[model samples]
Target: MNRFWPISWQRGGLSLIIAALLVFGTVRLFTNAPEVALILGEPWEDMRQRSSAKIDPAIPGSYWGRVITSDARLRLIDLQYGFVTPRARFFTVSFDDNERVSSIRMSPQIEPLLLDDTLKVVLDLQEQWRKGGWIPIRVNYDPPFADTPEWRAQLRNVNKGGTSYWQAGNKYQVMMVVNRFKDERNPTEERYLIKLQLATPWVSQ
Candidate 1:
């Protein structure tokens, strides 16, 4: 990363013009990277090379995007298919190396939602997916899968109006996770967030 910056600058008037050009070029290069659909089955290494992609060391095999940057905002489920998704802070994606499986993306809700709203939105998506030919099955989680959320992930059962979905299928494995978060300013008050993950089925990958 450091290589992207100029290491030395002579203390002269020429330095200012050179510095300006370098910075402008760098920003243009990043901004020029096109933000497109997270195609499933695309090579992970390929996406990593995109200037707009952001990779967090903590989450391997996953990236937050060229499109969903901190300043970038897009609400995709905006009644496009008769279903609207809960507003999210941002999204992260995952991919595999099959016949180009599905592009997996996870979105965390920006704010706490009433348990009722969570259920309604999740059910709406499930029904839509069902009609689209995706089957629902019990989710069998692995090590980091359970620990993906930074908040308390224990409140994931829909029965008590907690987490919404927890299964996967061919078309998409959508999970609406209800998480408990500690309010920094008000510790006594518990805040809950919805974590949505859309992925291509393992069978497809």
Candidate 2:
């Protein structure tokens, strides 16, 4: 295992399960992956209905629930099994008072063995959105990364990291990044959080 994958960040119990899945490829679990990019302004009820339907009886941790936050209400997804869907691990959807989706976030779990593999998938996914006219906004999250032409030029050498903020035709706000951070509790280990946050006022393409 890479020094990054460890028994930290409350993900310790998963270490063995993830390792086991890696060892016996034939026994792999698979399922339909959720789309990481979200459609802002979607009806909360409709979105909640679709999410609630994805639970698996076989995976006890598989669940979607709602919560109220200081700023907005949210739908949280905790899907524990779906190896076939790559890193489709968890999600959070926040909605406005009108019950329209105000933002959607996808935070996929990445294993050490598949860091590069997963990073490639994420960057490719971002490229697809770029092709659809999702250009980087003027500002972004902190970096050792950029989504500009100069930065994208290094795609061939991308390992598992970047920070990019973007917008599409004045309709949405996006932040896509592969963040690598060390757990203070486990200083020697490194981990990556592959996240995509899409935010907007009520509007749709």
Best-performing candidate as measured by lDDT: 2
| Model 2: pairs clashing at backbone N, Cα or C within 3 Å | none
Those runs of model 2 whose alpha carbons end farther than 4 Å from true positions after fitting are 1-31, 34-38, 50-87, 110-115, 139-161, 182-191, 201-205
lDDT of 1: 0.36
Worst 10 residues of 2 by lDDT: 76-85
What local lDDT score does residue 115 receive in model 1, on the 0 to 100 scale? 41
TM-score of each: 0.44, 0.50
- Candidate 1 has its poorest 10 consecutive residues by lDDT at 1-10
The digit string of per-residue lDDT tens for model 1 on 1-205 reads 1101111211121223222222211111113232323333454444444424454322344332222443111122312222234333344443332322234333333344444444454455567555655444443331112223421234443233233333333334454544444434445555444445454443221
Q: Which candidate wins on TM-score?
A: 2
Residue 101 Cα positional deviation in candidate 1, in Å, after optimal superposition: 7.6
Candidate 1 global Cα RMSD:
15.0
The TM-score of predicted model 2 comes to: 0.50
